[model samples]
Each structure stands twice: as C-alpha cells, then as structure tokens.
Target: MIIFRPPKYDAIDHEKNLKESDGLKFATEIYKGQRSLSAIVEFVLSRIKNYVKKLHNFDQINKYIQGRTKTNKSKILLLTDKNKPTPLIKSIAIDYLSSFETAYITIKKNEKDEIFDFFKIDKDIAKLPQIIIIDTKDNPNEKEEIIVYDGDLNKVALSHYLSNFATPLEGPASKRMDLLNKHKNINNSQNNKKDKNKKKKNSKNTANAHDEL
Candidate 1:
C-alpha cells in the first residue's frame, strides 16, 4: 500500500523526496515532478520491479497462486489527494489496472474517508514523507497482522518487518554460517594466545628453579 500527497504544479520537492528514498527508480520527470501521469505509472511499475528483485519468494508466491487457478498478481492500493481524475491520474490508474490488481481512492480536501478510519491513520500520518501499511495473513487460523510504516521509505526496515512473515530461502542459513565462522575464529585466536602464555610461564618457572638450584 502506498499513500502520498499529490504534488503541486511544481513538484520539485516531491521529486527530490522520491529521489532521496530511491523511489524514482524509473520515473522520467522532465521538469522535477512535472512529468505526465504516465511517468508516475512507470515509476510505480519500477517500484514493483524493485520489490520483486528484493523479495525472495515473490515469484514462488505467484506460482503458488497460479497453481491454485488464481490470478498471480499483487494487490496494490494507491491513495492520493486528488478530487478529480486528471489526464495523468487517469492514465496512471489505467496502467495500474493493467499491470497489477490495483485499487485507488481519490481523497477530496477535508472529506472524511473511511479508509483512514480502517487504517487508523490521521492527518499526521498523511503529512509524512510516505505511509505504507502492510497486511499479512500467513495461516488460515492466525489473525491478520498489520505493519505500519510512516515517514521516509525505509527499505531495510520494510525488509526486516516482512521477514517476520516470510523469510528469504537462504537468508537464515547464510546468517547462521557467518555467526558460526566468527565465533570459530575468535575461539581459535583465544586458544592460540592462551597456549603461548602457558608456554612462556612454564619456561620462566624452569629458569627460576635452575637459578635457585
């Protein structure tokens, strides 16, 4: 889920914000955020592409869905502060519909929307650099879990949070191996130092005994 405030005619600040977060992956903004809605759609597509690259089981999840005779796609929800659908917004919506199973909501100024209530978000959250709510349901019996992230887009935080739901195939094993190797090296170094100290002490004791004799 992605929620953002609509940029004004001069969207330089927004563009800069996106750039800072690496969110402008494939967006072509001729003049800052002055690009057409098509460009915005392209930017979103790029985000999805980046997501797939980072997510280990994204393809596997799609395959599972396909095997179950279901459409294999992500459910993306885009919320924007736009009262009317401009040409760019409309085109962006169309692109989203075609690419992913997407739903969008246009929020009017000062209009009370139910989505905010559902997400338990307020004006403060909307004012942030970005807001995304991730919902995961890993088991049939387990209650749905929601993770909310506000402020700038943090890929590391997002990855770590999502790992609680589904871990990467090799991530745990590689981490364990690294820890084991570190400990093994530390132990070997300590033992070598201890052996050297023991030999030095024995030699010193023998010298003292010979002198006394």
Candidate 2:
C-alpha cells in the first residue's frame, strides 16, 4: 500500500499554487535501472489528472478507478487528516488519487485492513509529512519503508514502491462503474430526445403563430 500524506499547507488558500509544486523535475534528473520515473509515474499521473479534470463528485471519481487496479491486483487507499489543511490539488489532482482509493474500498468484497501493517513506533508529536510504502505481503511490520517527504505532496517515492505487493480482491469493481456509465448514457440519450422534441414543439408553435399573424 502506498500512502501520501500531505504537509500542512498554511497560507495556500488559492488553487493556483499547486502548478508550481511538481517535484518531477528532480525525478527526471534522477534515474534508476533503464526507466525514468518521469516516463512511468508522469504518464500515469497525467492520465489520472486528465481523466479526473472535470470530475468533482467523489462517487463518480470513485467509479472511474475501480477497474484499473485489476491490472496489478493493487489497491489504493486515501487517509485525509481532517485536522490539517491540504493544498488545492488535494481537492483536484490528488483527489483524483483519492478516487482510486475510494473505489477500491467501496467495490471491495471483504471489509479488511490489508494495508499499513507497520510496527508501532513512538515518535515526536510534531507531525511531518511522509510517503510511507507499506508492503503487507508476507508480514506488515517487517516490510514497511518510510521516507519523510516534508514541504509538499509531490514526491517520486510512491510510484516505485507501489508494484511490490499483491492486494486482496473481493469482486470486480469495474462492474459497478459499467452499470453506472450505462445508466448515465441511457439517461443522456433520453434527455437529448426530450430536448429535441421540445425544440420541435416550440418551432411548430412559432409557425402556427406566424400563420395567424
């Protein structure tokens, strides 16, 4: 499981600040193996960002991610600290990520805690932001690694760490999304037909009035 906890953004009341926080610049300069993180994570993040650009409703956002996790049998989770103020992207781009986590939960068959099975460590109450990748495949406590990614949420650690563990699956969440989109399309078609009929009726009424004149 990959966890991205954002820092406490104090003064960013506006949404425009997120554009400047792309940490991928460093990720590009840094390479591992034959693959650049920008090529892997950047493309993936961009697709998610683009797909969710117009999405505002959490339910809709949740539905969109139900199927994609099946490719790797990986599940995503979002834990928002209501105590802290998050950046605007938390409601937008990161919230797109929040959708994947949401869909993972709602569409999941079993109600289980399969992520973040780490050791209990007592530390400072001064909470700094962290990107914690907890691998619960063998045992949760032994396989967890954490990097304190303070200052901003845009970090490169999670993309590399995500593909390690195999997650539990209950049923296909994609089915729920399929049905929802099916109904939505049917409704849209019906609405469009009604609109055309209404327009034609208005046109006929105008013609009758002109004949009378």
Candidate 3:
C-alpha cells in the first residue's frame, strides 16, 4: 500500500525560504541504473515545480481554488496498492493543478501487507493529517465486493480519476460513463415493468367492482 503524509506546515517553515541556488538538484541529475529513494522523491518534487511553471495562469489558478479558497494551502495524500500503477498520483495532481501552487504530494509504500494487522496505525494516520486511502486489487484485508468506498460516493471512482487526468485518446471516464448510463437504463426498464404490473392489477379490480354494480 502507498500513503502520503504532510507535515503540519506552519508560517515558520514557509518563511525560511531557501534561495533558488540552494534548491533540490535531483531533477537536474539523470537517473543511473541504480538510484536511491531520496533521489526519486527529489525528482518528483522538481517535476511538480516544472509542471506548475508550464501551466501557470491566474484564471486557471482561480478556477482550481474556487471551492478550496478557505485553506491557503492543502495537502494531497495519494495512496495506491503495490499492485496498481505508480504514476496515477502524478497524473491526478497534474489534472487538478494544471498549474496551482497550494498542494503537495507525499508517497509511502507498505510492501509487507501488514496494514490489516495494524488497523490502528491506519486510523491514526488518517486522523493525524488530512489523507486519502486508495485500495486496489485483491488485498487480504478487503472483502470480495463489486464496490468500495473512499469517503465519497463513486460508481466509477477509478474512471473519475482517469477521466480528469487521462488524455482524450485514453478516454477512461468517457467509457465508464457509458457503462454507468447503460446500467441506469437497465434499472429503469425493470422499474417500468413493475409499474405496468401494478397498473394491470388496479384495472382488474375496477372491472370487478363495475360488474358487481
């Protein structure tokens, strides 16, 4: 499993701004065959900055933060199971930002599948700071079900994430939307059949009453 935890950022951390010269250099360094986790993390952070620079515009920023304006900053915790793709978090962030500067992403991986045994740790992490948990694939802790919950309703949660980020060619959301609509139509047809049966019963009762008269 993957988890992201953001520190309770205060004014002090923000104020001690490092000079541009002293910035993290992992982005500039090309990856060798073997690399460290810290190096990869640094690269991700740099990528975040570069991504924001490209799409930075006031109108876009305003649209991104319209509902989230109350908090000057927000933390994004992206968790994915080991089996799922790792790049989903970056794509989702890019979709939301397009180029906003108020969010950060941290990633953690739990390879041992121990989260089930230590349920309290999971709860504590959730409570400590704002976070999001994503469960993918067959984990021992999860039951076999057609649907799962992640704080909000989502008939096609994965599709929503991909739709908002994935390019038009990929069209993850569009395909999912079609499937959802199809499901609804089927449900409506069943409901209509039930309604017709009820009407037929009412008609039979009325005819019997008239015959008695």
Maximum-lDDT candidate: 1
Candidate 3 C-alpha lDDT tens digits along 1-103: 1223232222223343344334433324344522678777755553432222111233432243332322232323332333222344444444333212222
Pick out the ten consecutive residues of candidate 2 with the lowest summed lDDT.
103-112
Residue runs of model 1 more than 4 Å from their true location after superposition: 1-112, 128-130, 168-213
In order, what is each prediction's RMSD in angstroms?
16.0, 19.8, 19.2
* Candidate 1 residue-wise lDDT, 83-123, digit = tens: 33233323323333322232334444553334455556675
Q: How does each model score on lDDT?
A: 0.41, 0.35, 0.38
Model 3 residue pairs with clashes: none
lDDT score of model 1? 0.41
Residue-wise C-alpha lDDT for candidate 2, range 131-165, written one tens digit per residue: 32222233332432332223344422333233233
- Could you arrange the candidates by lDDT from highest to lowest? 1, 3, 2
Candidates 1 and 3, the one with greater TM-score:
1
> Which candidate comes out best when scored by TM-score?
1
Error of 3 at 124 (Å): 57
Q: How many residue pairs clash in each candidate at the backbone level?
A: 0, 0, 0
Write down the TM-score of every candidate.
0.31, 0.27, 0.25
The C-alpha stretches of model 3 lying farther than 4 A from their native spots are 1-173
